[model samples]
Target: MAEPRNCSECNDSLYGQQFILKEELPHCIKCYETLYCDNCIACKQLIGCASKDVLFKNQHWHGKCFLCTRCNQSLVDQPFATRDDLLLCSACYCDEFSAKCHACLRVITPGSKKMEHKGFSWHENCFTCKLCQETIGTRSFVQKEANNYCLICYEKTFALQCFHCMKPIISGGVNYRDQPWHKECFVCSKCKQQLAGRRFTSRDDLAYCFDCFCNLFSKKCAYCTTPINGLGGSKYISFNEVQWHKECFNCKKCCVSLVGRGFLTCNNDIFCPDCGKGI
Candidate 1:
């Protein structure tokens, strides 16, 4: 050989030997690989080709160097998080920054799907209806003091249905005969007049306003020949299947009121005891 070339890395003569050229200087294979390897962001050292490497979030790290700060577990090729330049595994991140779900009491991790309402948060699968156990994620829901409910469950559990419309009565509903009805739905069965906040009567399952109840259902009073309003426990007298107002039960001949005292009826007429003896 005419001249011996000195390797720049080890200062050794490279005479007919395999080597690498780096930056216009000759370097041995071992030195050349070490100098050009990827640098580890975590350890801030060159990661040699023989050493395992981890690439995360557009950064590189040595396998053992990429570890959770809190748990000290290797995060190579695994899910991890970063907080203020501190690496953390999924479990350690949850322990540090997650909240307990109100329903299931499980830790809710950051960057996971969650449901929130009224300042309370839950995991996507943990948020469910109290009565039905149906998941309410991304659906309409009703909450009642620490309880979550779907619309169907909420209506069935809390709201009463109007008897007329057969739908849930959410507010301002009326109760008649142990049945529930909406304020606007409580109407007369015959005339369709509103019965809420007004006088009405019920025969079987049907409701009627005062006028409709009297005209359609009440019996005619014998004396006045008018429909008797016997609703609300109003007083009336009956003789031989004929109905009369309490004030109308009087002697037919003398027109004397015969309420309470002994009375008689003859030929469809009511008479006081004295008026009956005279007749």
Candidate 2:
């Protein structure tokens, strides 16, 4: 009979019977299955193998040994910072290193915070008084001299007077060029909301900014008094200063104008007595 070979792993001599190294043995080594050694290729120490093939990459770590550099708290499964030799985790990084704007809550990147207040930081343009929430857009605030007011706040607070009406805005206003205006005085060049602080004024007595007063007003409906869009049912006529639908005009004989009456309909006509028979 042939003598048995030694076991490759333990290097122990096998007598008479052949030593069979099981397939599971090599798998166990990769997964830190052996109790003697726990080191891994990534230099991390392992506590135990979660699976047959999965080895704990950090052999030095007993279990989840990640720590934040700033706070030194266990990182667990959270994102760890890998910046510039620092092993900080997310929570510690944000608390200790990241800068945030004091007024707007915007994240201030490194080298971006132009001003610092009580340890909080801000962008270069963020520190102006007009940049505050209520002051932004229509009106602007100046420290010494700067164009920082957003736009809206600048207009509301500073505009001088209405171009068309020449009415001064006392509460708040906009200044177009050297002229000032009330918001209601200037018509929107786009939507026609008075462009109180609009830069450009048009030639027509109906001066409008680029934003307000874009669409021209057409003929107005006599009945509804809204601009006409060509849905012709009743002919509209101008009586006195006001326009009225010819069919809707009332006669004194059919409807009596009564005081404090909500509505009166007669002879297919509606009348308000205070306005009289021609109404």
Model number with the top TM-score: 1
Worst 10 residues of 2 by lDDT: 51-60
lDDT to native, each model: 0.83, 0.50
Candidate 1 lDDT tens digits, 70-118 = 9899887789888898998999888888887887788897778888888
> What are the models' TM-scores?
0.45, 0.31
Q: State residue 142's C-alpha deviation in candidate 2, in Å.
A: 8.3
Residue pairs with clashing backbones, model 1: none
Q: What value does the lDDT take at residue 195 in candidate 1?
A: 84
TM-score of 2: 0.31
| Cα lDDT of model 2 by residue, 142-229, tens digit | 3323344444555456645566577545545665556766666556555566554445456554466542332244455444545433
Native-to-model Cα distance after best TM-score fit, residue 261 in candidate 2, in Å:
99
- What local lDDT does model 2 show for residue 99? 79
